[model samples]
Target chain A: MALLTAVELTIWVLEGQIPPPIPVPGVKLGLASVVTLAAMAVLGRREAGCILLLRVILGCLFAGSFSAIIFSLAGGVLSWAVMASLIGLFPEKLLWVVSVFGAIGHNAGQLLAAVAVTKTPGLFWYGPALLTSAIVTGAFTGLGAMYLVRALRKYRERRGF
Target chain B: MKRKTVFWLALFAVLAALGAGTYLLRGVAGRRAVVSVDGEPMRTVDLTAAAVPYEFTVETDYGRNTVRVSQGRIAVVDADCPNRDCVKQGTISDGAIPIVCLPHHLVIQIED
Candidate 1:
């Protein structure tokens, strides 16, 4: 569990090092979410949840500014809620697939928060622009996680480290 | 996979088309006195008559955009930032759309 928490932190920092966020409305590589998958795979759900929660909070503190916290927090919290509920039903391999929905949920949550904060419905016009991009980015991140899981399984097998 | 790809592609096309059409086809109405952010009715000044000077600041994350409004027209006469999206945004006659600087949290939308 301690090792996984450290891993989560490492991944969060790595994700942050990916400087200059995409110029698009809502898109991220989400390297930390790959660590999230690993945590859930190796540790049980409870431990994984703790790691994720801490990762998000600390990640926000370290990587993001004040305004960014709102968007990431909404996305992380909503994504975790929905994923936690569905985890029981789906196979472990499906974690990344669920993460896609989580990313979209995060975007939707951020947009809703922005509209509420700004009192502008016209801003929602960005929705279609965001969602289409989300699918592509989500799929890319999901595929990356799939490969990471596959590679991690192989390394853990050989090194037993 | 082929069918799913086709379905998603179609959905994207439709959404893009709708967004573009709505943006371009939006109608403009005649100018009148409208309430602005400061809760004052900004009356339309006669363009052919003498010009009046007005100035306002647009707060942005990177910096601020200072705008000048005169007789039936507005422009970003001075700005601190280089991108100049605020300057190019021209006059915000429509309340529905405002001069938005995404880099900055500033918006100048019209209101009733």
Candidate 2:
């Protein structure tokens, strides 16, 4: 769990440095979610939740912003909950589908946070754009997580860990 | 592909298409730019009437943002937030997307 958390934190921090592929606010690759999903698949939901919580808290600390923590926590918790509930229903091959839903949940949570903080219902206008980006980015991260899960299983079998 | 895979793919495709359509068909170009801080309208600039580009600073409890407005366009050219996402957003002349600075709780949108 600690190792997974560290990897996720690193990805979250590094991903922030890269300019968003889409110029829209709140749209990004969300690459760190790959680790969270993989951990949930391999380790279990509780472990995955731990890793995700640690990553969000630590990532915010590294960024040194109080407001950011609120957004990250809202997104992280919602995404984790959605993935955790869907993880078992879908087979490994269909992990990407589960990921897409989780990504949507993440964006919804962040949008809600933004609205609540700013008290601006107008922010909802960005919802469609966010939803579109989440689906696209979610599929990519989900595929990455699926491969990571498979590779880890193979490695464990070979090494007998 | 498997039936389950196909079903999921179709579902996502429909959702993506719907989202994309709504985003693309927001509205025609807008000439009035409304700048809001903490959900309160701080300023409304008439981009169509402004022949000369002008700038103003909005300072709130969160931080500060420097907004630039010109004919038919508006943008946050500067901000003291850590990310500067509002500034990086460049400018907007339509209602498709608003310039948002999450840290400073600022939003600028072009409306008809």
User: Which DockQ values do the candidates obtain, in the order shown?
Assistant: 0.12, 0.70
Highest DockQ against the true fold, candidate: 2
Among all candidates shown, the one with the greatest lDDT: 2
Q: What DockQ does candidate 2 have relative to the true complex?
A: 0.70
lDDT of 2 by residue, B1-112 (tens): 4999999889888899899899989846987988898889999999899789999999998999999888898989998877676787787888898888899888888888
Per-residue CA lDDT of model 1 for A112-133, tens digit only, reads 7656545556667656555555
List candidate 1 stretches off by more than 4 Å: A1-4, A7-22, A64-67, A91-96, A154-161, B1-112
- Candidate maximizing TM-score: 2
How well does each candidate superpose onto the true structure, as a TM-score?
0.58, 0.95
State the number of backbone clashes in model 2: 0
Candidate 2, pairs of clashing residues: none
User: Considering only N, C-alpha and C atoms within 3 Å, which residue pairs clash in candidate 1?
Assistant: B61-B104
